[model samples]
Target chain A: MPSLLILMPLAGIMILNFAFGRTMKRSAFWFAVVLFLIQIILAIFHHPVFWSNELEMVDRFFNVSFSMDYISFIALLSIGIVSLVSLLVARCSIDNEEDRFNFINLLVIASIGMSGIVMVKDVFSLYVFLEITAAASFILIAFWRKRRALEGAFKYILLSAIATIMMLTAIALLIVLAGDPSFSVIKSALGRSSSSFMVTLAVGIFICGLFIKGGLVPFHGWLPDAYSSAPAPVAILLAGIVTKVVGIYTIMRVMISLFGFSASMGRVFMFIGALSILVGAFAALGQRDFKRMLAYSSISQIGYILLGFGTGTTIGILGAVFHFFNHAIFKSLLFVNSAAVEDSVGTTDMDKMGGLASRMPITGATSVIALLSACGIPPLAGFWSKLIIILALWKSGHVAYTLIAVFASVLTLAYLLSMQRRTFFGKLADGLEDIKEAHTRIRVASIILAAITVLVGVFFPLMFDNFILPVKDILLR
Target chain B: MNELYWRIFLNFSFFIIMLFIAGFYCILVTRNLIRVMIGLELLIKAVTLFLVVACYVSGQAALGQALIITLIVMEVVMIAVLAGVVLSIYRHNNSLDARRLRELKG
Candidate 1:
């Protein structure tokens, strides 16, 4: 039944299209919502039926040998939560039920790909799932078929195809050296031939592809364009989980599982992290488009997760994992608020928005919660994760980097607060006096996400023990 | 068997590098979106040949074939989607020049 996590979604997609009518069309939204909820609950409870492999009869039939661990749990839970939030935004912002139905179907497909990504145990299988996710995302990003979306989609296609080629080329090289594609097999094989020129070349190319996929500073050309031009819900999904799963999560898994993190790799990771932080923060400061600014902020925050991970300690890894999840939740919350603003005000230009807090109280309040957490304000989830990362850096004697990371937070706070000031705090804009609140589903989505942020922040110790502590087992691998 | 891999790799290395360079040149120097797609196709073609030769020499023809087949299918899907986007862009702007795609600047 472990494969059911992936198989069931595929089956759902097939069955969803078989008897297409008004009921199936309308039920698509609720069906995906319930499926994501079930995914979240199973991940939370760590259900023995799926994780324990008791159903050998069914498992043998599939021959996939999917496994779940604490790291996968974190990834899977974030996938479910972000997909659910994306669906909520889609339902509210997309007035056409037909479009909603199509959007939900693609969303389910993307989640299946992400689930496969988290569960698979081989390099080749990992590539397959990554393509599945990317293909689904390309279609989703260009769903509106407008000029900006199309332009963004084309650039993404060229860049993503190049990344795929790079990764596949590396895999081919590894296959020639290592006889099998499994993580354990390749790790042992590559470990024996660690210092050869070909091996280093292969590893470097693969990581460069991942840097592009992750939208780090050097390879981030297509990211902001894709995020800002994609329809609102797609922005949430892309910024929240798609790029993260396709890029950052893959880097973490491949480095830890296949190529163990050595000091050299740690140095590379930290260098890239510092560059992305400086570039993303400064670029975000100049953005006037609401979604584009958030997209740049996404890059900056991703840099923090990389910095945490580069520390190469248990506390650092734990902090990275926690920050990954928090980024997904709060960033999606911010995007959902932007969707609400778009639905109500019909635009996302910050310069054109003023005093929206009075018009859309729920979105405004939730956005405040999300932004404070993003800025690492005290008693917020982001603060604790940042604290862990900075402490790890200091402990590891990277005091210069620690100072740089801390100062970057002030930059993060300044741009985000300026965005808030321009969009929500001033006197009402000319044409927005009659604006009403967003759709009810949107309000509820933001409230739930905000509540999670507050609760996770307030109960930091509880979350640390129950959800994040087990991530240390990954390092032991 | 390892000698066979090295022999085959040495024979094909120059050709693959040429293809790689040509593909990059095409992609970098092109102004037309269609030419960009063609360049990407060339790049994928180069990789596919490399994968095929690598699998042939590694004695893991089964895994190599499976990967290339999947790679081909994924490429077709990607090219189709990208072409559709290009078509839509043409419909909107009546030109396929890369310069026309400047609507998303800072």
Candidate 2:
């Protein structure tokens, strides 16, 4: 029942995309909303699947299987919520008629692909879904067809192609060494195999591929351009869910499910996560553009989550999950606020605006909330998640990493405050007194997200105990 | 004790490696987008050859090889379409150097 609640909307959206009709656009948006509401009901009520074991369906030569646990279930809910918010944001931001349809349809397909990635048990199945998501994202990025949009889309395609090839080659090597593509088979093979060289090579290649997709440090060249140039609604989905599911989630699955979370692998993840944290934070401090600074800050926040998960301890895993949820909410809120700023004032350059709070009150207040949330202020979601991660790092006795994590959080706040001060405070900018606030739908979505950010912070214990703790146990085991 | 088989395997691996390296070099150094596309095609071909060799070494059936060959054909068609698109871009901008095409940045 729960799976259907998630999968049916995906199927409906795919059909709606190609069906030529006058009412397709409105129908698709409402259909997507219906899907999200159903997912919400399922999440709140907690329906249990009848079958205790894994469910597999054999279609032609492919085996598509799904196994549900707390992590995937939470992931499904997050994707649903974010997709709905993005839809609402899009409905407000997009002006053209044709673009509205394409944007919403691509979003539906991308959400389906993301959900499929979380649900699928097979590596090849995951690859197929990832391809769907990546392809949809490529089209969406180039949806604008402006010169910058085209270049960003092209670079995204090229880099994604490179990463996919690396991953495929690594999968081929694993098949050669393990003789099977199943996660369980590969995991056991890596454990029992005497050829350390082959195992190391395979792991190295796979990690490289994952990191490129994950946008960690040096492999993050394509991220800022893609995030900054794409439409803000699409950017919300991309920055919020796409990177988390395809990149970070894959790393977690590979490490915990396929590689047994080895100490050496943990060390490697920690190093990369630390590098991403410092590099992303320091890079963000220098950005003058609102969206680009947010993009860099996201990279830094993702680093925190990755660092927590890399510790290979239960506390660490819990921190990582918390950080993931926090980052998603605040980042999407920030992106939407950026969209609102762009809509009202017609610019994303922070230097051009001295003050906007007087002109766009709702946008101003919500942007402030999101900025504080992102900066990890106490009583906001980001703060608790950041605290949990630092505690986890300290508990794991990684003193150096813990310090770096705290430093990165401070840096995140500093840049976010700078952006806020430039855009929301002081006198109104020249020729901007008449700029209006965002449309109704946009304000509603941002307000809901800001409220969630605060609610999640206050209810951290419930979040950790119910959702994150179970997932941590599963990953650490 | 099969010296002939050893000689054949080593010669095959050497040829495959050379093909792959040449294709990779072209992809890395080529300035023209069309030449780079050709290089990518060559690289795929070389990888297919290597995959076929691995299958032979592992005593697998011809299914993997057959699948790869079909993929190569599909890749060729896709590349042809992409080449047309790239050609249009080049004609519109009057250049083929990828480095010069930086109208997009943060």
Candidate 3:
């Protein structure tokens, strides 16, 4: 039954691609919707017999297994919701019939890989799933097959290839040391031995690979280009969840659970997190393209999550996990809003847009809501998570990082508000007079995401008690 | 005899590292897309050699062989897709130079 989450999508892809083909391209969209609904339902009712400490067999024949902890559950839930939203947004935004069909199929496949990443207990299986997601994303990023899109895809693959090689090296080293690739075995082995130079080298290489995937400073060359060129729905998926699962989640899992968090590791994470925050915010300040700015903003927001986990405290981990969920909602909303604006006005450049609020009221309102939430405005989901992160940093005695995080939120507000002013508040641009609200589908998706942000914000205590506290407990254990 | 084997293993590992560095240098310096891909292939080869060596040293040849097979399959798929992208780029731009494919910039 647990395996169905992955197999169902593979079946959907086969039926859509080979069985239906181009003759029934429209059916692909409906097929994807059905598959997503089924997956979501399965996720909601997914009750594994084993809990955090025990591994349950996902595929007995292959000896593959997964564990269900609170962290994996949150990851599973977010991947389901975010993928569904992105699929809906894609259906509305993409006009090419063939492209739409292929896009939906690839997305479903990628979601399977993502869920696998969250659930898998062994490093080798994790690598396989991560590559699956990476392969799907490479094609999705270049779905349009334009020159720039291809260029972005090529650059992404090149960088990712290097990261993969580094990761493989690390895996080899770990396997050689522990004589097995399972996380539990590796943990016990490492715990018994003093930190050797070879182990340190392997860990360093592994973290470096993850840093590239997560788009941290000094390894973020592929991010802006890929995000800007990808269709808005793909952009939303990549920024909102893909990077988090492949990069951030793995980092947190390995550092905290497998390796055991150390003070020196925490300090390294704090420094990198702080650096990404400053760099991403400052770079975003100069961007004219709305999606590109949002892309940089994603980097800055991701920095906060990293900073939270970097503190290595229970509260910090809770804040990081909560912020991870919150960032997915608000960032997906913002990207969907960007898709709408681009679809209606035919440009993502903020300079090419103005006073769209009067014409596209829903988009304007949703974009404002998303931006506010992203900026950590009071009474929004972003604020509570950022507050928790800041509090965690301060309590952890990283006063300098806490100060920078607070200042970065102010910078986030400055840039996002300026973006709002340029795109929606001032006089209507001359050429965009006939612009109208986005299609009903796009509007609906954005509204759903925006509603989540607001609802989560308004019910913060309920969210903390019911959802976050359990995940915090698991991380700290 | 064991000491002699150790010396040989160290020399081989050092040689693989040199190959890895050379491939990395090729990727960084080359403007041609094909050359960059060649560099990537070189790095993969080096890594594969290193993996086999590690497995041989650790007496886990069977497990290492299985991993290498999987790695090779994945590597093939990646290279195939990358080649397709390169073909498209060449068709669109009429050149294989990375410098020419610059429509997207900050």
Candidate 4:
């Protein structure tokens, strides 16, 4: 019964690919909506008693089990929401029947992989699921079969392959040391055993692999291209949740639960996080393409999330996880807005667009809301998370980083507002007289996301109490 | 007796690591897409061998073998898909040169 959460998506993929491939041409979108809704309902209501019972009988029957901690619960919920939103976005953007079929199939499979990653108890299974997700993403990014798409996918595959090799080596070393690959066994083993050169080396390699996956500054070569060239819905999914789940969340879980955070590790995370923030924000300022700027902005926002985790405080981790949820909402909304703009205007180039708000009011309004939320304006969700992170940093005596983070938030606002001014607020550019609002389906998705951002911001205390605090308690326990 | 066995295991592990490094070098230096794929395959083989050796040394050969089979299956699927993608790239550009596929820039 517990396994159904993962299996249902796999089943969806098989059914969509073969069983209904011929009959379900236009109805595929609705079919996927129902499928995702079922999965989300199951995830929310299907918490097994044995997960919290601590019974050996349960362990014997399921040697490999899903964790039912707050971390996994929140991750699962967010994955469900993002996958549903991405599916909706895809409904409007993807027109070709064959392409749509493949997209839904791959997205379902990728969702399974993501669900497995967060829920699984063992490191080996995590690696397997990570690979599954990576493989699916490569195809999704290159689905258009365009030259640029292929190039993006190829770069992603190459970089991801190298990261996989590193991770595999790390896993092999870890298995030898622990005599098993499960998280509990490895944690206990490391606790009993003293840190040695080999252990340190393995941990370093593992973290490096995750950093590349997460698109931290030095290993982020493929990120901009992959995010920019991917179909807009795919970009929304990638920027919104894929990197967060596969990259950032894994790093947090391993570093906190397995290695146990040390001061040196904290310093390393902060330095890297600061570098990514500055570099990503500054580079975003120079982008001509709209999606590319958002891609860079994603890297910058991710830096904030990492920096919060680096503080290793309860409030810090809370802020980080909350920001993770917030980033998923706003970033995906922004990407969808970019898609709406591109679809209506036929290009993502910022210089070629102007004064579109008068025409595409829904897209323009939602984009403004998403951008403001992203830039940490007060009365919005991003502001509260950023405030918490800064407070955590200041409390932890990282005065310099706090200032830098604050400064980078300004940089974020500068680029985003400038982007808004160029694309929507200025005088209408020539040849855009016929531009219309994005498809109703696309508009609905953006509206749903924008509403969540506003509602979460307005009701942040309730959100923090009900959602973020549980995750923080688990992490800092 | 156990010390001698341990020494042999350590020596073999070192050799495998060296082979892995060599494969990594091949990937870094090669410009041809096919050669890079070959390099990737070599790396997978080296990792597979290492997993087997680790399992043998730890007396968990059965579990290790099961894992290795799964790993090999995944590796084969990955390489096959990668090869198809590379072929598509070649067909489109009329060259397998990695340098020529540089349309995206920032």
CA lDDT scores, all candidates in order: 0.89, 0.77, 0.85, 0.85
Inter-residue clash pairs, candidate 1? none
Chain A alone, TM-score per model: 0.98, 0.95, 0.95, 0.95
Best by TM-score: 1
In candidate 2, what are the lDDT values of residues A308-351, reduced to their tens digit? 88888887877787778778888999898998998888888899
Which residue runs does candidate 1 get wrong by more than 4 Å?
none
Over the stretch A1-477, how does candidate 1's per-residue lDDT look in tens digits? 668888888888788889877888788887898899999999988977668764677667767778777888989999999999999889878888888888899899899999999988898889889888898899998898998999899888889999999998898888877867888998898889854887888889899998898898899999999999999989999999999988888888988898788888888899889888889999999999999999999999999989989889889888988999999999999999999999999899999999999988888899999999998998989899999999999999998889989999999999999988888887989999899999999999999999999999999999889889988976896
Best candidate according to DockQ: 1
How do the candidates rank by lDDT, highest first?
Answer: 1, 4, 3, 2
lDDT of 2 at A273: 92
Model 4 alpha-carbon drift over 4 Å, by segment: A24-27, A41-64
Per-candidate clashes come to: 0, 0, 0, 0
B13-103, model 3: which lDDT tens digit per residue?
8988998999999999999999999999999999888778767666678988888898888888889889988999999999999999787
When candidate 3 is compared with the true two-chain complex, its DockQ is: 0.68
Q: What does candidate 4's lDDT look like per residue over A1-477, in tens digits? A: 445567666765666666644776566677778877876675555455633544456445556466667667667777888899999888878888778878988888888888888877777788889988988898899887888888888888888888887888888878777878788888888777764776888889999999999999999999999999999989988999999999999998888777777778888899999999999999999999999999999999999999999998888888888889899989999999998998899999999999999999999999999999999997989899999999999999999999999999999999999999999997999999989999998999999999989999999899778777777666646
Worst 10 residues of 3 chain A by lDDT: A49-58
Query: TM-scores of the models, in the given order?
Result: 0.98, 0.91, 0.95, 0.96
Which 10-residue span in candidate 1 chain A carries the lowest summed lDDT? A49-58
| All DockQ scores | 0.84, 0.30, 0.68, 0.68
